[model samples]
Target: MIDQEDLELKCLGLIYTMVQNHLSDKQKEVKAELESNKAMENIYVFKSSTSLVNDMQVGKQGPIATRYAKSNKDISDVVDELQALLSKNSSKEGVTVDG
Candidate 1:
């Protein structure tokens, strides 16, 4: 003959064990997801950094180099033209003063 109070206590204990097992499984799943996310983040950082370095290396010999060279030449030409104009103006001013 099982007593009512004892039966209730056994049922509560069994429910408690089942809940604990369920919670443990859920905790493991959450931990695994967190680790997976961290690994993915690390991979993304590595790839981005590698790409940046490659781009920098390529810039020295690629289209970026051509662009920079063109810009420098354009600036030099402008500077030369300005100097020529200034010299011509100075010479005209000198002739006016001398005459």
Candidate 2:
């Protein structure tokens, strides 16, 4: 169970990490130029949140209701594409240290 703000933060973290991990400098520059007017931040948030909700992964979070009317398949597709992109390119295993 996650709140909307937490969801958005997760989305931002995922996108930012993926961008840092995958895109080369040239590709990043191209992306900046091509998507200058696009709301990329919101796009990530919307995509992740909608995906979780649609998949029934997000139950009510501590009496909070974070619901949306519409979910975008195109954004979900982008997420899926990103997954494939990461899998195809990523090699190093990551380590996590929890607090």
Which one wins on lDDT?
Answer: 2
TM-score of 1: 0.29
For each candidate in turn, the TM-score is 0.29, 0.24
lDDT of 1 by residue, 1-99 (tens): 235355643211100111121346777686457547843443211100001123324575553422454444444554455455456657877832221
- The residue pairs in collision within model 2 are none
lDDT of 2 by residue, 4-87 (tens): 354543332233212233567897787677555464444433223222333233544331222332334435555676665455
Query: How many residue pairs clash in all the candidates, one count each?
Result: 0, 0
The lowest-lDDT stretch of 10 consecutive residues in candidate 1 is: 10-19
Residue pairs with backbone overlap in model 1: none
Error of 2 at 6 (Å): 19
